[model samples]
Target: MARGDGLVAARHLVHYGYKPSVYYPKQGKNELYERLKTQLTNLNVPFVPDFTEALKSADLLVDAIFGFSFQKPLREPFPSIISQMEETRLPVLSVDAPSSWDIQEGPPKEGPGAKFMPGALISLTAPKPCVKWYRGQHFVGGRFLTRSIADKYNIDVPDYPGVDQFIEVGVDADEKL
Candidate 1:
């Protein structure tokens, strides 16, 4: 999983009164990642070693496994992990685009990625090109984007009501989830 996203998600979950456990097979050496992991530990979030065991009790899975930079031929461990996710059919909320999806191409036409579909997705900053294939609850986050940046990029920033951090797209404001 993406360590930074996982950290923020865990923090939010804790804030919203959910006890979340993380299963990270390989720890990062960077100080930022170290600090993030430490913060999770400080919050009493368990770092599980076994994905299979974690799956048995997990109510939902936040798939921060990969992001926009990922271009794959189904590399080690992830293929198996993603396969397991597919097999379970549990509700998965992918960060950014779903892991292994080509940003421009959307979901792969074949392979393990093709077999998996997350129940929801939260696009950071803005929605990527791949979102066209995402037939699930989609949310736009990173509300800190400046108006100047939006104009420079010709991005249509959604008019979020009040102090909401995220706004659901492709859905009516009254139908917020």
Candidate 2:
């Protein structure tokens, strides 16, 4: 998940009266995981490594590990962990598309081979291209709405535009834009 979206979702869930926990892979030396941990901590949300003990403790699980940026099959521990969640029949709420499913073409498989579709999926920014192609059985009644972090949290996101503004206007747009 994008750091911004994850934070906004964590905050929104808390504001709506739900205690949310953010789970990510903590094994190996992953700097990304550390950054995400800091972000979740800043939001005052709980963070746990992907483990059965953590999954078992949640009243609801929010699958935010794979968001719009995922383009390849999810590897290792994540896929294995997701399979475990499927077996438990826990109520899951995904942040965007379910892990392993292509956001543009629906899940890679169907029927018994199909992966778990969360009880609900909170689509951030906009509806993913796959949402329309996937059968209702995959998504069920599982869909929620969200806004971009800039819109939801009123934060300024930085990007290459800052450079363009500096070149064209001879001033730093990072502060103003």
Candidate 3:
């Protein structure tokens, strides 16, 4: 997901009465950074380079830094960034799997104080095998659904079940078949 799009998404959520914040490290110039800045400006969502400040100001923090391809020990910037995020102590909502986590086997078994641990994980498309195999106690919610972008294209999407509750789908119809 584009950083800009994430900002827009946050703005939309807030517009509809939800409190969300974007968190990222203060890395130097990059294409992603430029795009994110532009998008944040367009959406009019406040952002802070410091994770501590962002966390203090937000009720829910969305982690959109890394995708599902991460499969290694978190290095300097990421580890430092994740460390700051963890210190925030707010409920985290990761975009895909938690950063620095192994998507295939789940997060590494380093110890209780690992950087990949998140409060909540929002899986896109399909739920990663690790999510089920590794019992993430911090996991509070998830969405394993897909959406159609066009007539010919369908993409796996993360679940964003809002605060409202309802029963829209029936489960017994297919059992009769």
Q: Give the top-scoring candidate (TM-score).
A: 1
lDDT by residue (tens digit), candidate 2, 71-168: 66567765677677567677766655766677776666753216665666645433465555433222211113233645686543223343331111
Candidate with the larger lDDT of 1 and 2: 1
**CA RMSD of all predictions:** 3.4, 12.3, 6.9
- Ranked candidates, highest TM-score first: 1, 3, 2
lDDT of 3 by residue, 47-118 (tens): 666665555556666766665756476765677666665566777666556665666765566632264566
Per-residue CA lDDT of model 1 for 69-120, tens digit only, reads 6776878777878788778767898898888788788777887788778888
Q: Model 3 segments beyond 4 Å from truth? A: 1-5, 26-36, 111-116, 133-177
- Tell me the lDDT of candidate 3: 0.53
Off by over 4 Å in 1: 171-177
lDDT value, candidate 2, whole model: 0.55
Range of the 10 consecutive residues with the lowest summed lDDT in candidate 2: 165-174
Pick by lDDT: which candidate is best? 1
TM-score of 3: 0.60
Cα TM-score per model: 0.90, 0.60, 0.60
